[model samples]
Target chain A: MAERCAIVGIGQTHHTARRDDVSIAGLLREAALRALDDAGLDWPDVDAVVIGKAPDMFEGVMMPELYLADALGAVGKPMLRVHTAGSVGGSTAIVAASLIQAGIHERVLTVAFEKQSESNAMWALTVKTPLQAAVVAGAGGYFAPLVRGYMQRSGAPEDTGIRVAVKDRANALKNPYAHIRDPNLTFDAIAGSPMLWDPIRFHETCPSSDGACAMVLTSERAIPRPKLAPAWVHSMAMRSEPTQFAGQEKINPVSGQMCAKEVYSKAGITDPRREIDAAEIYVPFSWFEPMWMENLGFAEVGQGWKMTYEGATALDGDLPVNCSGGVLSSNPIGASGMLRFAEAAMQVRGQAGEHQVDGAKIALGHAYGGGSQFFSMWIVGSARP
Target chain B: MADEAKPVTNIKTPMRLEYRYSAGVATSRFLRGIGQGKILGQRCPSCRKVYVPPRGSCPRCAVPTVEEVELSDEGTITTFAIVRVPSENIDVPLPFASVHVLLDGCDIPFFSVVQECPVDQIRIGMRVQAVWVPKEELTSTLQSIRYFKPTGEPDVPFEKLKEFL
Candidate 1:
């Protein structure tokens, strides 16, 4: 278990489909330097670095950390690469926290990113295993079927997915660092857009992006001096199971349920829906908002769709989710999970300007990956855990 | 319409990406087992759990699976996906089914494909058996089973194969 860790710094690139202006190393440094600046620290203050991503094939680069050591200022420092599929970003952050919690390092810099401009995401996902039939065409392709399943099971109104896309995009307009900021976005355009997979539409899908998210985590003693106001890390948790099994509930996976329960217990929260003021959840597709609402115990099973319909998950709702647009607006696969974790910290630190939840006391940072089997969540509070 | 109906030489810039990974010790052992025409699984001493497509340790117990077992190539299809996309290490016709096959004598199911049949006929609980590659072509992989085919027997009862879930 980690002793105790706090997030002192957070930074992320302006997400977009193409970042032709910089190399993969340059992109990572852009986010890292800004985070160090935010924390009021220099390179030497960082003792180690942890990097993460969805897969190496996404950029056609293998073990990329070895090539990016110098750019990230991690050549002389220990660097670890984490890949728990999409949850890798959150796991990388947790690994950094563990180092601080374990009394091994006072300060650890964690960064996760993906340069999707270099290769087609569709092609990367289709990389074959011998004799194994391929069903996934791309991120959108693999998830489309799941979205259809969600709609079928929940009987959620067709307007619900459209509403989620519109709401998150509207929120993105307030986040300067968000990848896609089209103020012209509206519900009708989303509803009228081509349906890529039955219930999911093109406008409703997350954009393939090139961006990075970074954070500087420190031990208890490392805080209280020389940095911008820091958000104390209250607690963190991760859990996983096989990708699929018969009788496995993919929509609201049991592993996600256990992970949430473990995290809340460690954080000492009796009622998350009331105790936590806000949240930033992973929602690459619009349907996940309701699915996660139930999985996180914010609402009952099969009633997650009710939260969205009742305006409980909206921006001005009781608990605003993904105020920074989330994966729904700017999805840089590797960095997306961290962005949720970082955005949650931004809320507690009061750094979130327009999208702030207004004096958030405690918040939930959630991320899941690999057919919804891997879950990494944290409960962060303004007050110490 | 002319271009759409054009010949094979009329195409353009195609998308191609490949990954080359080091088959670390665990993968090496798995493939070597295939090369020898044997199905080997790693067993966790502490939990006594067996993992096919063997890994270094039990994911749950986080302890090493140092023991080995040779499993049978016959099992039932648990669930599957039909492939319509072409990719590396596989060259099959469109609309082929990829099924999770629980090999006989193994505790868990590993991924494999079924051939010598139509896609619509592939069903869960279908009895399928492995068809091995020629010995010289074998490597450390589940690919040692060239493809699974219907055993042409009465389908296995759901109650007998319920543990796969």
Candidate 2:
């Protein structure tokens, strides 16, 4: 049987469009050192390192873990690299937790980062490849059609995405590390933004950011020495499906459904809406929050967007979502998933600073990548599992 | 019914792409060295292993490879592949040897074309040397080394070459 694992340390960089002050190595060290400091430990205390990012091409670095090993104190220690597209951050954390859970290591440090300033995110993601159809309009153009499909299927109003944009951006005001913090942002500002893709406004999209997130996971024995109350791992799960197939459901993917089912089952959660105190979900385009809600079983199909309209997902709502701004506010691509996971842990530990969800005990962290196919999620709680 | 039962067809789409990739600090130095007809490699201070195409940090030691080491042009061929099938991008003639040469004083092998020798005679552990283009034609590109030719020296021992392969 696997040993119990708990998150003892969490740290993130102050996300921004351009972190020109530091090189790629310096950027990663900023986050890793913070995590080690938070754990009250040094590089010597880490047994292994697992790192993740969106794509090597994004930073113009091929297998950056090779170059970042020293910055992370991974010299002479086992280091594993993970790249499952957007969900890589959460997957990297899961891999670290697995090491502790397998009794292979007492402590494992996991990190995910993206230096988008080093290269262009749009061109890197949409670079044309041999034999593939030419759909090189970047992520917003590609997903806008599917968003339209979701609206048609659910008959949802036109302002759902805008509402999500406003809510998440407002939440970002409380988060100092968020990349896009416009204190004067309003619902009309979002609605009035230019339409980048039909039915998708420019303000509703996530900004390209350069940042990193790191977490120090340890065996249950290390919990007593933690600086703050530990966020216990209730359950962890991942799921993937092929990129495309005829008649496949893209709006509400079966892979996301299956992944949520596995995580909820492992965590002994039946009613997710009631059981999950807060959620830090991947909502890069704003509308994905509600779409994922339906896919993750938080709400019935066609009704997820209503939660936003009724303010059920606000900071003071019954189920607060993206309380630390979320990807909509600060999306560092590769680190976006771990940021979600870290925010959820912060909520449970009451260490989220100004954005802390009041009295949050149990929370969900969700991330999806690669055309909504790849999924990784974990549930954390204040109390031990 | 016949129309629906017909076999599916493939769509052919050609794409023209452009990108300006950054070589970063370590690689920029290596590229500059190639322009000067000098081959450079980085040595890991902790492990002492040298890396061709010098990276900013070493993968094994996880430390910066700031120490520069000049590599000898003469080396041993650790392994190779004989290419026969052709593609639009394949410039070498059919049945030519694409070789992995472990340059003398360097720990890792780098890929290069092996010319001036028959593909059948290009065996592993064979001694070879880099062939550079005309001095005036030299650029920062790896293409500066046109190919590698047999050094006509004694074959390196398999025991010494096994780790590289």
Candidate 3:
């Protein structure tokens, strides 16, 4: 049997398009130090370190973990670097938790960061390869068709995507660390925005942000008595499939569904929509909220859009999703997923500050990457199981 | 401190990488066929699904696809997006239809641009045929198909192509 793990502390940087004042090392250290401070611990207290990021192309820096090890207090200790496209953050956290759950380490530190201002993500993603057509512009170009397919199959209203953007932006105002905080964001503002990829409008897209997120996971035996509760790791799961295959389901990938099913089963969740009090899911494009709502088994097929239209995903709704403003408000590619995971832990720990869900005892963190083929999710709760 | 003596927060470092990419045996054959005004696909022996611009092996079955199959230039647009944003890679004019066309006899959709039609008019299940470059200018590259154009055929029902989407 695996030992229990608890998230004792979580920290994140103030996300923005540019963090010009700090180098990559400095940016990561800021978040790591905050997490260490929140945990009431020092650098030497951590037994191991784990770091994650999207790709070297996003920042034009290869093998950054080797140099960042020292900055993250990994000297003479085990250090690991995780790369799963955009899901690396969630995967990294899971790896770090495994060290504690396996009883190998007393405490571990995990960090994820993306300095997108150093390079262009669009060009990095659309790099031309031999014998392959370069018709896809960026992530949006590749996913827009799938979104169109989802709209057609579900008969969702044209403004459904815009409504998601409006809600997330409104929620961003409450999150101090959110990158894009708009005080006057309206459905008209999002709907009137120029369409970038037909159905995906400008406001509906996630901004390229430079940020970092860090967390400290410790074994149950090493848990510190802090002011706020520690979020106990209830269940974690990851699943992956080929990026493209004949008859593959891209709109709602099976990998996401299977990953969610495994996680819910382990957590003993029969009805996730009711059991999970809060959720922080990766939604780089606004529409992914509903798309993932169905993939995560929170709604029926072709009816996920109804949750968004009915305000069931709002902050005060039954299951508040992305109360930390989500990817649409602050997307530091590599760190985006970990932000979701950390926000979920925050909700369960009652440390979410302004965006805290009232009496949120259970929370879900979800992320998908690489054409929705890669998925990593976790369930966190206030009480240890 | 004087303004001129302030620290430099940003620097310009432009870099470029160049490498030769070798197309595998299966992809080379497809590229060579397209140069001769032909669209070639390969069939997975196990699943029997034909893949356009074959990737040398079937992703699901993880087996080499040896059998070659010829596909029709015309196909149905399973899904599409009208790109209005400018990209450094694409040279087409702003606001063009980028479609995923499920070609005849092929199991998967081939991504390509559709031209010679209004962006607004492009819809799912629309029939389209590839427009190759001049014969003398053909090359062993997907760019040989300048773009796909409308064939004016009746649109395929969405139910028939939903699986490809």
Candidate 4:
């Protein structure tokens, strides 16, 4: 078996539309420095660094790791760059954990970020290429039809998306770092929002954000002698499949299910909805909260929306999901995945102050990317295996 | 898994984007040379492989390719595909050929449009030369080279062009 690892520190920037105060490196360093301070360690304590981000085209910076070496304290150390589209942040964290798990590094620093103000992500994601199918609209346009398919298949109520939007926006008020903090958000406001993509209102979509998230993982033996509780890494897994093929199901992708199964099995979780005390899932679009609920096996097919409607995934529910407001509130493309991973760790460690679920012992983090083909998930617990 | 559903064959959509690439040092120099009627390649000192449309670093060697090499405008078509279907970005008429031009002294071939020949006449190892825009109208972009035209020379041996392809 691989060596055990625990998350010793976590940090994230205050997500928003623009972070004009810092350069790209400065933005990363802000989160990294915070993580280092939280861990009570210095740059020399980190054995290596792992960084991930979405397409470089999103920020007009190609292979930015080369320029971010010094800021990440990898001047003469091993540094790995990961790019798995939107799931890159979570994948990067997994790679960092693997370093400690494999007995390679005692402490590894991982960070992910996106500066959306530098370029228009909607345009970047929907750009036309020669000899390819056209995606005239942005992400909402691309995913609206899929959302419609899910609604049709599940026979869910038309207001499910609006309910999710209101719930998450209300939750964001408790999260100071969240990009969108609408304390007065209500179902009516969401339902009355403009329809950017049919079936996806303005309030139902995630905001474009500029932010970063960082974490410090340590081998079991290297855990700090005196510190707040650390979140033990129970299991992590990633899965992928072709983006599109004949008869492929995009709504509940097989890759996402397979990935969840592996992670749950590894963590010895028999019933995710009951056993997982909390979940920080990637839910950029409001409908995705339920769609992913079904895909991740938390609810039976065509019944996941009931969990949302019944408030089972809310802050006071039996299984709290996205207690930190999730991607729907702060989506910094690259960092969104890592934010889920970090927020899960926070819940397990009892570090999620206002949004914490009472006595959250185990939590799950999930992220998906690239037409829902790439999946990354991790299960963390307050106790050791 | 649920029973498979019917396959989707076609869906039409449109996507248009505007981007400003910083075109770092290597690329800026390469584009400048193109505007001046010269094809340029950068040599990876470690691997000795030359790259056209010079990049920040060599993919194979994982090292910066700095030494600039002047490449001949004339080259051989290492491989090509005939376009039978038209799309929004493809301005060339149907049956036009897109070729991988292996410029002389460069190990890697660059993709470009091949014209002045019938689609049926296009073949691997075909000799061709760049058709540049008028010198007075030159700009720091690949558009400086309108297309590649046949040079009427004997085809390069298939064996020699195989590795380049």
Candidate 5:
């Protein structure tokens, strides 16, 4: 049997469109140091480190992990970099946890970040190559058509996307580290927002943020007394498929479904919608909230929008999703997934503060990337499994 | 700190990279066919699926697709989006309808912009046809086909296009 792993430390920077006050290394160190403080340990206590982020082109940095070794205290220690597009954050944390679960290390630190203000993500995403159609405008443009496909298949209300945007922004008010805390955000504001990509309004899209998130995972035997309760890892999984292939399911990707099924099974969750108290899923676009809800098996096909309409995903609902305001409120692409994972742990540890679900014991963290082809998820609980 | 002696918070650095990208054998064949005002796709022997703008191999079967199949220039829109935001890479006018056209007889959809019709009229299942540029402007590039335009055919039923979506 594998050794148990516990998340005893979690930290994140106050995400914003531009974190100009610090360099990339300084930004990472801020979160890493805070995580170490939470774990009641210093850099020397960490046995290894794992780092992750989006494409280096987004920040005009190549192989940033090599330069960030000293900042993360990975010198003379095992340091690995993971790149799975936006899912890198969640995958990074899973890798760190594996070190403890495999009895390879007592304590491991994992960090993921993105400094989008340094370079243009749009330009980086839309880099033109020879002989190919430059039809895809950006991430929004690429996903809008799939959103339209989902709308046609589900027959969902036209305002479903707007409702999600409003709900997530409202939830952002409770998250102190969230980037966008628009108290005045309303359904009308989102409905009237410019339609940058038809079926996806401006407010429905995530902002380009500069931020970092870090966590410290330790073997159960090495768990130390901390300021907060430790979140025990119940299960974790990662799945991926090709970006495009004949008969591929773009809207409700099969990889995500398989990944969710494996995680829920390993966590002994027969009914995730009831067993899990909260979730922090990747929803860069507002419509993806419903799409992912169905994909993650939280709701039945074509019924996810009803959950939003019925207020089942709100902070006070049965399965409160994205209580940390999620990627919609604060999206540092590289760290967004890790933020979800960390926020899930926070919920189980009762450290989510204002956004905490009442007596949340078990929580789920989910992240998808690269045309919805890559998925990483984990289950955490306050009570050891 | 005095206002005049304030430290610089950020420095602007614009970078550029030039690359020589090869289209490879299969894509070169597809581009050459496009230059000749014909649409070509490669057939996967194992799955028997035709892939337009072929990538030389079938992603699902993991085998080389050497069988060239000519497909209709007409297609049905599987999905579409109206882009109001301007992109540095796309030269199309604002509020253009970018669509995934499932060309007749091909299994995968071809991504391109649809023009000469109102943006609101661009819907899933609408029939469209490729509009090639002037003959003299034809080159070994997909740009030879300027844009796709509505073919005035009845929209394909949602059920028929469900598999493509």
Candidate 6:
């Protein structure tokens, strides 16, 4: 059996389209320092550092972690780098937590980031396969058809996407560090926004941001600190699948379902939708909110949009989702998943300033990347499991 | 300490990977624009977000930036890098300027080549104009704007371009 690991600290950079003020090293340092500060420990307290991100090509840098090692204070310590496409951020965090869970390290710092300003994501993601001769365009192009497919199959109304956009932006308003905090935004504005991928609108998509997210994971013995309450790691799990395969369900992906199942089981959860008080989900596109709802067992596959339609995910709803605005508000591709993970910890620790789910005791953080091939999830609670 | 005194034999493996990409249709248009003496951007009808090297959809709004807007040949340098050494795959000249320029009238700024000046002279918030190539050399990519040169105007105050940071 694996050892128990709990998250004692978390940090993230103010996400934006461009972080021109700092170099890649400078960005990582900013997040690491914050995590160290939150843990009430210095760089010397960290046993190891794990860096993860989407693709190196996005930043025009090759294996950037090698150059960033010293800046992250990992000069003489063991370091590992992870890449699992879009879900890389969450997978990276799980790997660092595993080190503590395995009794290898008492405190591990895991960080993930993306500098999209360095290169156009549409260009980097537009890979030309030899036999595939489709001018299908960027990431939005590839996912649009699938999103359309979900709408048609689920009979979800066109306004469902608008609701998600408004919901996430409103949640972003509470997060002071969130990018593009527009208090004047409304459902009308989101619905009236230009439609990029037919059913998908402008506000429904995630921004190409520059950001870094980090956390300090510690073993059971390392905890029991006096400064602040720590969010105990109840369960953590990850799953992956190939990019494409015949007859595979991309919208309600099986990998995501499996990841959640494993986590709920490990954490002794029976009814996730009710048992979990809050959730921070990765919704790069607004439509993903409902699609993931069904995949995560929040509702039946076709009935996922019903959950959003009834406003069940609102701040005052039964299960508030994306209370920190989520990726729809700020997305640094690599750091997006870690942001979900950290946001969940923030809730359990009573650190969520404005978006706090009132008296919340349990929550979930989820992230998925690529053509929905990768998945990482965790369950955190105020009391130790 | 005792293990340090013993002779050790180890094996090493050499591994390498390379990413080769083509300038697609949109990139071709931008590069073609660079080849010529013009700058181009695509406006999203859905959200009105103008994308440099104009592509299909805006990542934020999920709307196709369809309107091809011809921008002024001038802008400001937000940040830049003086390429002293490049990787094996690089085919450009050394000491070249890779600068992000805020295209005229556009909300978001983009990267462009800086030329017709010394590498040491470039500074953030510097007002510079695009130096275009002959019309015959035009392509449909960002390369259309050959590079930015010194505008001879004073540098914009730090507070002025703080948002670009």
Model 5: per-residue Cα lDDT at residue A135: 92
True contacts recovered per prediction:
0.05, 0.00, 0.78, 0.00, 0.77, 0.00
The C-alpha stretches of model 4 lying farther than 4 A from their native spots are A131-133, B1-165
The superposed Cα distance between candidate 4 and the true structure at residue A269, in angstroms, equals 0.6
| Candidate 1, position B34, lDDT | 83
For model 2 chain A, where is the 10-residue window of minimal lDDT? A128-137
Interface Cα RMSD for candidate 4?
16.3
Backbone clash count, each prediction separately? 4, 0, 0, 1, 0, 26
lDDT for each residue of candidate 2 in A94-127, tens digit (9 for 90 to 100):
9999999999999999999998988778768876
Tens-digit per-residue lDDT, B61-143, candidate 6? 65545577787767787655554433232334665656656777665666555677887787776788976556665544443
Model 6 docking category: incorrect
lDDT by residue for model 6 (A16-65), tens: 88887887788888888888888888888889999999988787678988
Q: List the residue pairs that clash in candidate 4.
A: A136-B14
lDDT of 2 at A59: 73
- Off by more than 4 A, model 2: A130-133, B1-165
DockQ of model 2 vs. true complex: 0.01
C-alpha lDDT of residue A336 in model 2 = 98
Model 5 local distance difference test score? 0.93
The residue-by-residue lDDT of candidate 1 on B23-135, one tens digit each, is 66765687788889987888767767667777677766666667888888888886555655444435656656666677876766776678998977876678999899898
> Which rank order by DockQ, best down to worst?
5, 3, 1, 4, 6, 2
Q: Is candidate 1 or candidate 2 better by lDDT?
A: 2
DockQ of each model vs. true complex = 0.09, 0.01, 0.78, 0.02, 0.80, 0.02
**Candidate 1 chain A: 10-residue stretch with minimal lDDT:** A129-138
Off by over 4 Å in 6: A128-134, A224-226, B1-165
Model 5 docking tier (incorrect/acceptable/medium/high): high
Ranking, lDDT, top scorer first: 5, 3, 4, 2, 1, 6
Those runs of model 5 whose alpha carbons end farther than 4 Å from true positions after fitting are B1-4
Clashes of 1: 4
Best candidate per lDDT, number?
5
Candidate 5 chain B weakest ten by summed lDDT: B1-10
